[model samples]
Target: MKAIVHVGLKPGVLDPQGKAVADTLGRMGYDEVHSARIGKVIELDLEGVAKDKADARVKEMCEKLLANTVIESYRYELVD
Candidate 1:
């Protein structure tokens, strides 16, 4: 089984990296891109677990180590 975790700042949170990316995009003539958000994607493989169980475990991993819940939000997907 495989799990994909995406972590990012919640709405209203300050994102300096996002701002920089947006600025660069504007300079590169991407005028329609008014904003951008920087985030992380993590992929993991698990052994001997059902999809539901792996999903739960991946969520736990995000809460315990992969994500900072106070300032960040995370969503995950399970892949066979």
Candidate 2:
């Protein structure tokens, strides 16, 4: 199984990097972009775990280490 995790700041949290990118885009003539947010992706491979167990393991990973949980939120997908 394969796991894909996405970690991002919660809404209402300030994102300096995102803001910088948005500002730069605006200056570069990207008028369509009004704002921006930044996030991260993590991909993992599992050799022998079942799909159900993999889901729990990935969720635990996110809660314990992959995401801040307080200021950040996370979601994940499992693939064969």
Candidate 3:
């Protein structure tokens, strides 16, 4: 099985990196962009696990290492 995790800061959190990207885009003439948020995508492959078990394991991985729970939240999905 494969798991894809996306980790990002919650809304209302300040994202300096995202802001910088937006600013650069604006300078480059991407005026349609009002705001931008940055996040991470992690893909992992594991064996011998059911869907529910895989979901739990992936969630644990996010909580333990993939995301900083203090400022970031995460969501994950399973793929074959």
TM-score winner: 2
Q: What ranking emerges by lDDT with the best candidate at the front? A: 2, 1, 3
Ranking by TM-score: 2, 3, 1
* Model 2's TM-score against the true structure: 0.91
Backbone clashes counted, model 1: 0
TM-scores for every candidate against the unseen true structure: 0.88, 0.91, 0.89
- lDDT tens per residue, model 2, 1-80: 78999999999999999999999999999999999999999999889988998899899999999999999999999989
The Cα error of candidate 2 at residue 70, in Å, is 1.0
RMSDs, each prediction?
Answer: 1.3, 1.0, 1.2
Which segments of candidate 3 are over 4 A away from where they belong?
none
Least accurate 10 contiguous residues by lDDT in model 3: 51-60
Q: Candidate 3 residues 1-74, lDDT tens each?
A: 88988899998999999999999999999999998999999989889999998888888899899999999999
Off by over 4 Å in 2: none
- Comparing 2 with 3 on lDDT, the higher-scoring candidate is 2
Q: Backbone clash tally for model 3?
A: 0
Q: Which clashing pairs does model 1 show?
A: none
